[model samples]
Target: MGLFQPDTDIFCHRDALREDYQPDEIVGRDEELQQYIAALQPVINGDQPANVFLYGKAGVGKTACTRYLLSELKSDAVEYGVDLTTIRTNCEDLSTSYQVAIQLINDLRGSENRLKPTGYPRRQVNEWLWDELDSIGGTIIIVFDEVDHIEDDSILYQIPRARANGNLKEAKVGIIGISNDFKFRESLSSKVQSSLCEKELQFPAYNANELRTILRQRADTAFYEDVVPREVIAKCAAFGARDAGDARQSLDLLMEAGDIAVEQDADQVTEAHVDEARAALERSRIVDGVAGLTQQGHLVLYALVMLHEEGKTPTRARAIQDRYKIVCDRAAVDSLVPRRMRDHLNELAMLGIASRVERNKGEVGGRYYEYSLDTNPDLLLEALDETVDMVGVTESIRKRRS
Candidate 1:
């Protein structure tokens, strides 16, 4: 038994990623870190009355910085007898104005040290939330993550002017909006644009060198010393930077590479190992993204791609329906037509998976069209864990000769 037979995976749970990962003390984000801290500085001095809007592309550390700064601001506010209440919500779930209000009231009541339910009426929740804030007689900071997903402007109108809202004769509120979508600021109603855009912080993508620094940091903190070589981290960083300069992607690549080395019972994760891991991770990520879609949408896409795989992929609506049933059977789900099927097809088209082609001459009227999958079905299914259905999808598959 040699000292270095192989560096198999020594799994560390912290390396596993959630959509929300704070990079604080994990990687270098000096510029982004300082801007965020400065923006929240006013809150500490009781001076920055304006709200902040933070924007950047996905995986660019926008949310992480906001969270880190807000946490610190709350801690410092305590010393000044500043009754600072920070309520964080994902705007995706609280899309509507009413949902936002309901969430705000619920959060506020919970923070009062006497965990009471808001119990406010549905129709009156927004009004009640405002009144409750007024009664608190202090400053409140509401941070909305994924703020672009907010369906309306009501919540924005209310937060910045919570003090002006007749009910807010007591407390004042400062808004902090975080969004991955850059258009969120411009898309806001003119009123919301003016108020919430008072201060803006933008996070840029990490460069290759930066990704390397990030990867090495995670390597040191997450893995046992020398468990993963510096070269492995470099490979992961280079791979991710070439793809999109995505830190999350780089981190995922490192984790995936480790898994590959482990599965192979190899002691060290090598370049070839990382390549195999990248392919596997890429497919898994794509599949996971698709799997998050509605079941029917998934079925429709799988059906079309499988049809393509079989060279029996028909492009017409009825043809798609036929393939869709085959897919449903493979998925062991019931077939749907007209309303449900149309809805699913439209969604697939929207996803850029399956697109509609013009119907040929003699085809039935009323928009008879061909539908096709953008990628190989097997690849997609592999990525999405849909391979389970491959053996059973209605179409008979002929194996290629090895």
Candidate 2:
């Protein structure tokens, strides 16, 4: 009775509420959501609360959950006449203490330019941060997403420790930090850990069934009538759970599958549509990974991918250096040759974009092998194309045609 069965269109644009549709919403985590709400009740009712820590893997609803709860809590706090001011900034973006303070001040003041005027100095920024919190005379919540990124511990220590140090004038401060580093929890010792981890919530990756349920809810809201089959949603759930169980990735796959069906004029979404969706999402992932690299790192990776695509890949530092030289000339940037390139290559290796392999000289002689891009060269290049300011090579090959 349907327009097309699962086999009708390879895939259907799910009428389900699309996640990438807007402000990354929280699909699941009902229990976690409740816990977060309960924990914040102290501050919401005008009592200064303990700092909280939320940690989880990528796409496991860490940012989405905390953000959603915070959004809702903000509205409730305002209605209750709580002068609750909050500022959320990712530590990864603000790697240093100064940057964090700048963002915090800018948020409190509601002016990015006035965060710190010329020649104010970092110490002054810190002072200003404390002053602003103290002046509020109410509850202030500072949420640092990816708190592990903060190289300077002062930001964490000073805020929660202000009262203990007798530095508070009136207002009480609480911090809610979010991080994905599994080992980061153990890294913190008594004092700072005690304060920040007052309430700890670990968000685990969603299982297949859980993802399916989530997608189903989203699909029902986002897609048209009965266009997407249950099979397609399950496929996405299984894929996400198997591979790092990233919800964001699954969401991307679902959205892309819909676009594919739309392009082909398919009346119904089928297994084939799911496959196409996965492929498109995979390519997008590679591109996003590459796009995030710094300019020099981007060039190094681009050169490596170019070499590998042509069949001259899995190259040594010297060989990669030679290839990199061409990329440099093309980009019109003065480039490094061997030694300098090694550092960049190592950096790439650390990022999981490039991998290092050990080779032997003569039957386990002095060891030295080669380097290779961990991801597909073509995919990485395309990914970089989206982010890089001036990427020339649309397509590069390692070998010539017959």
Candidate 3:
């Protein structure tokens, strides 16, 4: 009768689907795993490690596979009597080479000896890093997950060539750069590229079958027997495959469905639960995406949504500009110019909240672009209501939805 009573019906080991939970086996990435193992083979042989770069879309098992393989490599290295050390830090917050150097030094020094965020010269930071690396005096692998987030390539250039540059005498260091941006490699300077791209691997998206295999494994582990049906698994897999080909998305769908079933006091998860979960997730995504926009961005999106509701899109920026000005005035903010308005529209298209199409009118007229909402009208209106005062537009959209 307690409000927070535990429910044993749906999830047995829910942490199985948690982000930090590392699976013992990596499914749907056999080919990539073999190549990755080959790249790490030098570690076991007590040779200088290769600087490996892995590029792929998000949730394609790049980091998960790395963790799985590195765990095994660590085990094997111990048995083989290799002096190996692995340290990982996400680059999402560390922007400059100075920040990265500070982070690496702090990581090597442990939490009790952590460095302050500021008040250090760049050269001194690099020297401290080299000093720490030399102190370790063995093969060390430093992994920069989301490596593209770092603004400068100075660290990328230095780490791989630290020995040749006489920065370190004892320790042999290697870098593992994991990024979701495929173009990040091309953006690197030629010097940095030659060093970091010595060994590169691409992780492709998982198909429906592969997602099914992965979800089935987690479902079996996380839920009691027969709590998750094969049909529900297939539906989740298909939805994930069709949307982003992300294993994480499939797992999220399964987990959300289970939570919904438990909330409803049902005995088992069903396809209807998955459908409800998908709708809820889509709405959450829209809300989150909309929440990140600037005030002007919210105005622009509201204008586009109004146009979409009126069947005026995929219209041109000129049309959206007119409505946008009105929205800006209503919100008591100045409107942006046509060009700046188009920039927001393009950003919306990039975020998948809106769709853009380009048309050419032969050599005389040049090319023009049209824009429209790619998201659900009802959802966008609801999201906009939370961010901006679009009462007139909101009432219109909700009226149609009803």
Give the best candidate by TM-score.
3
Model 3 TM-score is 0.92
lDDT of 1 by residue, 122-192 (tens): 55776777677777766778888888877887778777876665657667678888887777787888888
Tens-place lDDT digits, model 2, residues 1-402: 977555333333343434434344555688898888888889877887778998888778877776677778789988988887777887787776677887787777775447543356867777787787787778888889899888766678778888777777687889999998877878775677888888999898899988897777767655676777899999988998987687777777777777777778877666798898887766766666666667777788878877776777687888888878888888889897577788889877756678899888886567776888776655665566576545466543423322
Residue 106 error for model 3, in Å? 1.3
Each prediction's TM-score against the native? 0.71, 0.71, 0.92
Ranking 2 against 3 by lDDT, winner: 3
User: What is the alpha-carbon lDDT for the whole of candidate 3?
Assistant: 0.91
Off by over 4 Å in 3: 312-323, 337-343, 346-351, 355-371, 396-402
RMSD of each predicted structure: 6.5, 6.7, 2.6
Give one digit per residue, the lDDT tens place, for model 3 in 1-402. 776977789999998987777887988899999999999999999999999999998989999998998899999989999888999999999998888999999999997778899999888889999999999988899999999999999999999999999999999999999999989999999999999989999998899999999999899899999999999999999999998799888898888999999999999999999999999998998999999998888889888987887788889899999999988887778888899999999989878899899999889978999888899877887788887564366776668757
Clashes of each: 6, 21, 0
Q: Report the CA-based lDDT of candidate 2 relative to the real structure.
A: 0.76
Question: Model 1 scores what on Cα lDDT?
Answer: 0.71
Model 1 TM-score (2 dp): 0.71
